[model samples]
Target chain A: MDDKLMLMIPGPTPVPERVLQAMAKHPIGHRSADFSAIFAEVTENLKWLHQTKNDLLILAGSGTAAMEAGIINFLSTGDKVLVGTNGKFGERWGKVCAAYNLDVQYITAEWGKPLDPNEFKQALEADTAKDIKAVIITHSETSTGVINDLPTINQYIKAHGALSIVDTVTSLGACSVPIDEWGLDVVASGSQKGYMIPPGLGFVSVSEKAWKAYETANLPKFYFDLGPYRKNAAKNTTPFTPAINLIFALHAALGMMKQEGLETLFARHDRLRSATRAAVKAMGLPLFGPDECASPAVTAVMPTGVEAEKIRSIMRKKFDIALAGGQDSLKGKIFRIGHLGFVTDRDLLTAIAALEATLQELGHTGATPGAGVAAAGEVLNR
Target chain B: MDDKLMLMIPGPTPVPERVLQAMAKHPIGHRSADFSAIFAEVTENLKWLHQTKNDLLILAGSGTAAMEAGIINFLSTGDKVLVGTNGKFGERWGKVCAAYNLDVQYITAEWGKPLDPNEFKQALEADTAKDIKAVIITHSETSTGVINDLPTINQYIKAHGALSIVDTVTSLGACSVPIDEWGLDVVASGSQKGYMIPPGLGFVSVSEKAWKAYETANLPKFYFDLGPYRKNAAKNTTPFTPAINLIFALHAALGMMKQEGLETLFARHDRLRSATRAAVKAMGLPLFGPDECASPAVTAVMPTGVEAEKIRSIMRKKFDIALAGGQDSLKGKIFRIGHLGFVTDRDLLTAIAALEATLQELGHTGATPGAGVAAAGEVLNR
Candidate 1:
């Protein structure tokens, strides 16, 4: 049981053996020509994944680091930016903007609810002076299992001529972002979520409009400075020492992702999301968020009979499947099941069956013992 | 030839098989209690490695990010600081300060020379008004392979009542830093150099004095912010999603380092440094820095008659060994041989013998065929 633990968390998700094997190889010099080839190839494939030809840069840090870089690199002190706050990550962007002395205007929604695009539209329309320099939105809120209407909100930002800084940490690989089609400006994500790799690397895609903002943006930055990254990226290298083994892991994982193709990747996540939602519904447990705004990355469940922490403990200790507990205000009220990255239909079914058993062990009078798996099977088979 | 490549670079020095195996294991959730145990163990071992009981923080970033965090967390805009500039990394710290709009007064030294402690002493003594807030020093200049006199220079900072922010990237594991005895305020390092791991994770050890400074320091930072790191570290966790696999590698590597003991680790590096220098000297290659200030991590050589790049190329193609070329202005004039981390006496002797063969193949008439290895053998055997 020492090595049999399964990861069902949103981040630090399950990685493939091939990816781990690639990462286990001895690291070559980061500055070597061979490393450059890998860098160039990774950069190209990253653009393909994002569905954008924007300048994609990699940094050795977390999603927070990437999102911080996304905001700080394009705005100066007192630059008015609209930040959407519904979940933990959205509020995080607001905090990042505040830390840099940006004037943050918040468009709020209750927890487990998506941000209403009409509010963003009204805000942008009322800003007749166009004081709003950027609109920051988290596409897939990992905390509450809510995916905001990024496309609709981004339309208003484009109409207002403001750059869009998006957090696609949980949405990029799980769903279709289509950066070029959506005209998203600055999109940030991390390796642990949808990249099917371990944490440590952050990816940011910058549009030309965002680069224009960077030209005049004044923030005290060195490590997260985007200019040097862009300059070094032109030569197919990083300005700082990269995590060489992680890059190797990325190279292998991206190769696998490419072989799977984008449609299949997104379709698999869609099926898993539906199956998870359907299975939870059949088990008589309350799903936290509305079905219309469910995230493909994770499902948040607010069960009435079984305690959230108890469910997570049993799932982890007995089933060896690690599920995520709620963060912040939602703690002890909800538990999350991550079906992101390297997860398959079989994994979803296994987790649902375990959950059904956990409910039974907790003495909950559910519909039936096998009903959860049957519901999940209905969606997965479809 | 494919998988037989040997790394002789300062950073990303050869990783141990056990460490790589540990990293290859499945990643667990960072927020899980199991990961918290690993985090606690790694933190304790990091403090032991630094010879300090100060708060040691691990971050998922590169060394530049760690050093930048070390600087930005304790000082505000226009805070006067003296930055030592002798080589690439020293100048890099200065650039970080400049980016943060610090009033930087640099202590002078040539590229391959150690920073003169007297210059710092004189400057600190002359600052009667105590305008200087902190003194930034790089303990080992990786570019020029020169080790600065941190103890002597830090005395001036102490007398001047200014905090010391030190970059111990190359010096931490190669030699004894003894942060507590030295009263160093903020010391930053990376995992790839002396930890016998690949890059991606950075470590920063902060003294109580630096924490007091942090309460008043106002620099806009979110990802590199030390306040949250300290707060989280107290709970045996990180502020952000950590590089879980890299942390596993660090766990394995630091365990090995502890088994070897501090004295043995430093002695091994010292022995390799001496042997590398002797071998380079015997092969008619001019050592770039003086013996008194030689860094135990890497040795730079300015070859005569035989070209520097040519030697590196042949060493790579023929022996499948990689050596670091000089950076910036020193490029094309010198090549560096790294004896840092997992390198042993046999690796040094092997590299020397390969160099002799390379010199002979290049038709250089300066020395006998086996003199280089002979000189290295004497030091290694001693």
Candidate 2:
């Protein structure tokens, strides 16, 4: 019972025992040939996972740090940039832009709604003068479990000759984000979400266009400076001291990911998403976001008969299952169940069964016993 | 021979097994109450190690990131600051200042020499206009194994009414910084050094004075922003997803350090430094920095009859020991032996004995066969 706290949150996902053991290995000097060999291999594997031919750099920070670096490195001050906001993460990117005194243009929607790609297209077309330098979008809004149409938005960015900066934090591993095909200029993600590792390391991929913009970008930066990272990365090194053991964990996790293959990995996540959503709906809980735009990483549930906090509390205290509550304004309104990163069909069924038992125990007349598990099993079987 | 690599580098120091095992534990949601409890405990212990009652914040970054945050969070653009440079890290702070458009004044010294406390005194005394907003100093220059006279230099900064922003990256846990006693405003370090953990977490301790400066200081930051971190720390949370596993490692390592007690911790480092210095001296290798200014964390040896890189290569290849070679202009001229963190007296003796064998094997006449080990033993035994 002590170490059995099942994580059903979007990030800080379950890690495999192999990856955990890899992290426990003694750290070697970052400058050594042994480390360089591992670093080079890990970098290549990360590129494979990201589906990018661009320079994928790793930083010793969270997803926010990677997102901030993506925003700051490729644009100068006062440059007009369109930022999409629907959730906490999307809105935070706008704040990052404003912090650097960028001329921010927001394209916002309701918290649980996805950003309209048409809004981006319209704003980008209006910038015929080409003053707009970049477009910041969150691919998956973690707070609301809404996945934005980044592919369509990025196409507009390409047409407008503006860099596309995206936070694919939760979407990167759970869904297909073919960076090269989409022509996304910048894509940022964190380790905990999809890498199947612990937090602390962030990954960022930069296309040629983003690197070109780097030449003229006038933002003042040091630790998050991408140029040195690119140069050092070429030599199979990092500009700063990296999280050594975390890198080891990533190396092992990426190896596992490569074995799973991208197609299977994405398919697994898609199935997990369907299963989690199906289970929640069968319990008579309203899904916070619509099916069309729901994230493949996590499913947000808005219970009618039961309290969201109560469900989370019971899940945690009774079943030892940790569910994430809504962040920001959505607080206590919805509870999110994450089935991303190292989660399996069996794990989804287990979570669903526990949820049904909890609902029944709470005397929720709308929900039937075993209905949630049956619904999840149907999706998993399919 | 495969997994037998021993790290004797300045960073990525030897991590204790307890810490590594702690890091290998499954990561929980950072927002969870369980995580919050661990975070609060970790924060308290971190303050104990920092020897400060100030607001100590941790970032998922390297030491450079911590130092940059310390610089940017307390000063505005074009704020006059004096930076001391005797080695690589010292020079990096100046570059960080320049990147931020800070009007920087330099206090310079040779790489192998300690910073003249009088130089800081002279600069502070000359600034009758109080134009200098802060003074950045590296307490232990990791690149050169030189420890600057921080106490003496800090007094001058106090006299000048300028904030003392110090980089204690390689010195914090190795020796006493006594942040409050010295009235130091900002002190930054990394987990890879004296914290006895594998890299990734950077820590910055801020005094009330630095927080006061934070009200007006604006350098345009997001991820490295310390205010939100301060606010979150009060609630036992971080502004963003932290390096969860690394925090676990820190928690374990801190517990060990607490058990050992601060006095023993500092004394152990002191003994290691003396033993390493004595061994290198008896081996007829010139110490890169003078004895009075040598760092407790690492020892740089300038061999007379052996190539530094060659020594490092042979040690790494044949004996599985990883030693650090000189950086920048001093490259290939010096090799450094780290004696910080989880390093023990026996480890030091093993390294010195191995070095003696290496010298003999390399046909170096400058060093006697058994002199290094004997010398190290004499000092270590005392």
Question: What are the lDDT scores of the predictions, listed in order?
Answer: 0.94, 0.93
Fraction of native A-B contacts kept, per candidate: 0.95, 0.99
Off by over 4 Å in 2: none
Docking class of 2: high
lDDT tens readout by residue for model 1, B1-382: 8889998889979999999999999999999899999999999999999999999999999998999999999999999999999999999999999999999999969999999999999999999999999999999899999999999999989999999999999998999999999899999999899989999988899999999999999988998999999999999999889999999999999999999999999999999999999888888879999999999999999888989999999999999999999999999999998888999999999899998999999998887889899999999999
Report residue A236 deviation for candidate 2 (angstroms): 0.6
Which structure among the candidates has the greatest lDDT? 1
Q: Give every collision pair in model 2.
A: none
How many Å off is the CA of A35 in candidate 2?
0.7
**When superposed on Cα atoms, how far off is each prediction in RMSD?**
0.7, 0.8
Off by over 4 Å in 1: none
The window of 10 residues in a row where model 1 chain B has the poorest summed lDDT is B277-286
- With candidate 2 superimposed using the best TM-score fit, by how many Å does residue B109's alpha carbon deviate from the native? 0.3
Give the TM-score (vs. native) of candidate 2.
0.99
